[model samples]
Target: MTDTGREEVVREEVARAEEELRAAAALLTAGIPRVAVTRAYFAVFHMARAVLYAAGYEPRTHEGVLHLLSLHFVKPGKLAVAHGRVLARLHKYRGEADYGDSFVIDEPAAAEDLVAARDLCERLRALLPDESNRRE
Candidate 1:
């Protein structure tokens, strides 16, 4: 693709990520703990994907984002560490939520996960400048 195509993809990802962030925030406030935790994963995924998109890289799945972050060579920070651990929990939770009988994630656990996820999202947001002046 051309330079124009890359820029467009980045813009699209930024828009989608910001929307996900807003949805995550709403879910957090509305007491939908499970949905909030899941959307928080999406929020962080999109936020990280936006950065990769701008750098001319293909994006990954939500779980892939977490896996990549877990690698020590990439963006070593507290957020990344938290993202890795939370991602492991999310992977298990997703599997249980889909296929396990009598398995569930409680509100307290979801609430705790949401906080970690939100913190990771915030760290990603801080890494990028606002949309209006995002010329990188």
Candidate 2:
């Protein structure tokens, strides 16, 4: 695909990430904390994909996404390493919430995940090409 096509995909992913974050918030409000954590992790994961797409890389797996983000953005000083840490933490919590039989996701934990996901998406959004530029 052309760079233009890639940018469009990135934009779409970013939009999806935003929508996922909103869904996470809704789930949290509805008192489904565990599911909220999973949704929040996906929001950040989509944001990571957008970043990778803008960088001309499309990772095929969750680990690939995280690895690319660390190599391209965090290590290169484009994004702070703390963002990577937040992503890692979210990923970890999401796995526990989803797969662990006894995992407990309380209100505060879900709220923190939501906030972290939102911040990560915003940071990645700034890194993507402007919509006007990508449209052309």
lDDT of each structure?
Answer: 0.61, 0.86
Tell me each candidate's TM-score: 0.66, 0.91
The best candidate by TM-score is 2
Off by over 4 Å in 2: 132-136
Clashing pairs in 2: none
lDDT tens digits by residue: candidate 1, 15-83: 666676567568767777666656666655666665555545564566655555555315566345555
- Give the Å error, residue 12, model 1: 2.6
- For 15-134, candidate 2 gives per-residue lDDT tens digits of 778788989999999999999988999999988898788878989998899899999999999889999998998898888887899888798978987998899888887887676124
Q: In model 2, where is the ten-residue run with the lowest total lDDT?
A: 127-136
